[model samples]
Target: MASSEQHYILPRPEFDKPTKVLIVISPYYKAIADDLLSGARAELDAAGASHETVEVPGALEIPAAISIAYRQSNFDGFVALGCVVRGETTHYETVCNDSSRAITLLGLEGASIGNGILTVENLLQAEVRANPDKQNKGAGAAAAALHLIALSRKWGRSGREIGFQPEGIQIAGKAEGPTTA
Candidate 1:
């Protein structure tokens, strides 16, 4: 048999600045919650992101705390990290929908909210997202926040004309001198 080939993928662009981030984590699943925090920290350290973490009682409390964090100061971005596994009742839907809607509203209002909340049917899937080496939802959230931070900076510095495209894939504006964000 022939030898198998290996492939490696690299992360996208990094924000080159003292990115200030606020991470709101719900302690519903304390054990797995620790992994999300650790993964977030690892990503932040690797990317030189300045971040602060706040603990919430449960997933339902995450959005409220996030709202408070948003009103506190001019943080570059926000990360909402929580885990809501399906229970006997319909509580999961409420938490997931409400929290996600809150974050979406914040983003639409020009406040970037990196959503890393895990809505899983079981603990196994939640563990997958909490895995530091595999999915690492926290790291993914950090990356998103960093991206939004960079875009916000670019907008502020470049007169707010060059904003993210409709799909947020690329920024649209006059092609001129590139400014450091």
Candidate 2:
């Protein structure tokens, strides 16, 4: 047997360019949320992305706002940033579960929503994750959304392709034109 080593080649994908995005945040933990938003804003600014940051009452409102923003069709993606710290009551569980599920469903239903909600037992963990230099979750969420958007574009779907083109320029394989009767 011949001994040989093979090198792997990596391919770089082309991005769809900077686009408008929405960041829905919860005011539950204003301090931590501020940190998260700052991190996210830094990344967006660097990428020249047009974006809006909206504050909701809590994590529960994040998803609904996201859905509304998506329906409005003004943004290419969304960042769902929130923090839920467990307390003595059941409110924590409800917020965590509902917020997470809503975000998941939003992602599944042709929406590019990055789940950045931090459900932790205490404020320290949330701070660690949301802090600009500590966790950089804001940047992480933005990157995730951007990466997903690129993947969607590469797959020939933008989560809004529900019909054919008016000009009828069907994108076919190398074999060629559309066959018609």
Q: Using Cα atoms with residue i matched to residue i, what is each candidate's TM-score against the true structure?
A: 0.78, 0.78
lDDT of 2 by residue, 135-166 (tens): 76877787667666666666754434455555
Could you tell me the lDDT of residue 137 within candidate 1?
81
TM-score, predicted candidate 2 vs. hidden true structure: 0.78
Q: Could you give candidate 1's per-residue lDDT for residues 12-107 as a string of tens digits?
A: 447765778899898688867888888888877887878888898887787788787788786878888889999999888998898889888888
Q: What overall lDDT, based on C-alpha atoms, would model 1 receive against the true structure?
A: 0.79
**Model 2 stretches astray by more than 4 angstroms:** 1-16, 157-181
At residue 46, what lDDT does model 1 achieve? 82
Residue pairs with backbone atoms closer than 3 Å in model 1 (clashes): none
